[model samples]
Target: MDRHSYMSFYNIFDKNLLEKERTRSFVLLNIGDALKNHEIEVYYQPQVDARTGKLCGAEGLARWNSPKAGLMMPGKFIPVLEAANLTYKLDICIIRQIARDFRKCIEEGTPIVPVSFNFSRTDFETCNPYEELQKAVKEYNLEPKMFRVEITESTLMSDPAKIKEQMTLFRKAGYEVLMDDFGSAYSSLATLRDFDFDEIKIDMGFMRNFSDKSKKIIRPMIMLAQSLDVHTLTEGVETAEQLSFLQQAGCERIQGYYFSKPIPYSEFVQKLKTMDCCDDLKDCEK
Candidate 1:
């Protein structure tokens, strides 16, 4: 990831945005080539069935390997991409990449598990993401079951009417739509009422403040999902105690540092081959 190899990529940007310049555009100038050259990648974090402790699905998180800055996390560059009105571009890149990766896993005879991807609310407004995504999935000659779409609870709060339409469209297309960051915002109940989510990702912020009180809050969330016939997956599960409690509380799936951090798809495929998910998993950090 050396910029010197593609120094001309910087020439397209205003000199002020170049590496070592004053602004954050250092990240911006890298996006086009990043997507074209495959520097921006989708990393997979394993989710396991709580009861059986086995690999069930994964979340495909975007990671940018900037030639200028080594590797960049989503939080660092996503907002910049958003402010520049280019967020939709990056989101689509990840979706298309996931389709290819999922297709590869299938052709190689790997156990096919669904991989969920997040879509920013801006995506709904900026483009016909639903149509574009459907095309990508179709192009790969894959079924809808291998692809899952995750939407943040807050994204719905921004535009419930539009969000509702999206929820219905995706579900009708035979794709499972997940409510991501369930408890992070105040509109959880409202979002739940208006839309049908296949799964609920109870926000990890609740786990950050892990306590007796938070456990009480989490318990009901799982029960509520069960009542609605929706599966539950809790994020930020980083310890034996948390895993044990989530399993006992009847959560269907769990993802966090307890099992592994997000790793490249190649490593994820390797882990899938050997991962037992049998309570003896040590922390994975690659």
Candidate 2:
């Protein structure tokens, strides 16, 4: 190709890239509005007990159906929303959805299990997270203990004082607080010390090496949490080998596809019903 043609093509490519970025901003703006209009749905991922293969709990992950985008996951829109300083808005939407689902499960006699949802650093930075959570809970007739909050170490470690207050308020309300993605950052110990975490989720990176590095890290961490009397859940157990490793390592619970993938609320309820029937059948055999 000639130099003139190549230069023209590069210019057009640059303009197209710039236009894409501009379009992303516009899409995010619409997403913000759509969220306010109740356009988001919550997806539940089951956390299973590695020992008994029972459904323990589920994580509350968000999904949005945008008129333009068709369907979207948090990863696609959250960063853009955060960039626009709208994370708190998104957080509230998620919290409300979780409360709604909890109510539904309770009404169905499903023994409301804990649902873990992520909170960013901004959620802690708020001056009144305790009252905010209480208000949200009341709105949906949910008890504080019915849900769990997973805050990253980075959030708590950002401003120790604020996070401490936030944690105290949440505990006061009888909510179980968890340190999510533990050991992924440098601030795990500090966050644990500052807040009385009810659970600790082992980072997936560590779990991936559970078999070969058992004695070195995973086993010790499991033992350490047991000694402290705090529960531990291993994330990303996608294979039987990994599940066996975690079970032998003394981890109490796990969340991954080795049991079942995350599903919509209706589907999850159906699975629970199936589980109940299976349990009844086993009892009959005995």
Candidate 3:
């Protein structure tokens, strides 16, 4: 191509990219407003008991349907909020929404199970996540047993001492703490030794390239958590083979597209009813 033509094309491309970046940054910064307006929604992905294949629990994930931006996934938005130091806003939104769903299910006598959500490092650095969690629980009149607090392995590195103390507070308040993405980062055996985590969540990334070697790695992690007396859950189990191995390896809970994908909690409730898991749900929390 001619130099002048190439230069003209590059300049226009750069300008368009810059404009898009600015627009995204504007939307991300004002996500605080999105929270208040109920524009951010929660999608629940069901967790099944590995032993019985019954609905046991679910995780609450964030979804934003932006009028201007269309559907925003966690990958598209979470980092932007984290960069803006506004992650706590979204954290509290999901926590409260999950609590509200818990209340709605119980009040309607619907078959219910615990819902897990996460706390980013910003939740600790920017605000009192535990206090906000309590406010939401009380506001919705929901029990702590109906919730699990997930923390990624990397988040523990942000402030290990402070997070350890905060996890203690959560435990004392009857909430279960899970080490999310257990093998996704530079895992610290020391972190596991220090924190009183009730569960270890093996990440889905490991399943993407599932092989004999993957089983070699996953089996031992599950065994380690078992030796430590913490429950084990593996996410992203998308096939019968994945489910078979995880179940055989004694993963207590399996969450992935093998059984279901993330959906509205109302739809999950309908699925539970159809599964006839009501009788089993009574004992799932145990």
The prediction achieving the highest TM-score against the true structure is: 3
How do these models rank on TM-score, best leading? 3, 1, 2
Clashes of each: 0, 0, 0
Residues 23-115 of candidate 2: C-alpha lDDT, one tens digit per residue: 567656686678877778888888877777776677988888777767777877776766665667777778888877777766766654577
RMSD of each: 10.2, 6.5, 4.9
Each prediction's TM-score versus the true structure:
0.87, 0.84, 0.89
User: In model 2, which regions exceed 4 Å deviation?
Assistant: 1-23, 208-211, 276-286
Residue 37 error for model 3, in Å? 2.1
Cα shift from native, residue 214, model 1 (Å) = 0.6
The predicted structure with the larger TM-score, 1 or 2, is 1
Candidates in order have lDDT scores of 0.83, 0.74, 0.84
Q: Which structure among the candidates has the greatest lDDT? A: 3
How many times do residue backbones clash in model 3? Answer: 0
lDDT of 1 by residue, 110-167 (tens): 5557789888878877887688789998898777767789998777777878878877
lDDT of 3 by residue, 1-286 (tens): 7766654333446887786587668666668677877889999998888998778888999998776677778877887788778889899889988877777777777778778999998889999888999999889877777789999878888998889888999999988999998888765467788788999889898898899999999999999999999999998989999988888888999999988899977798797677745253364222
Deviating ranges (above 4 Å) for candidate 3? 1-20, 278-286
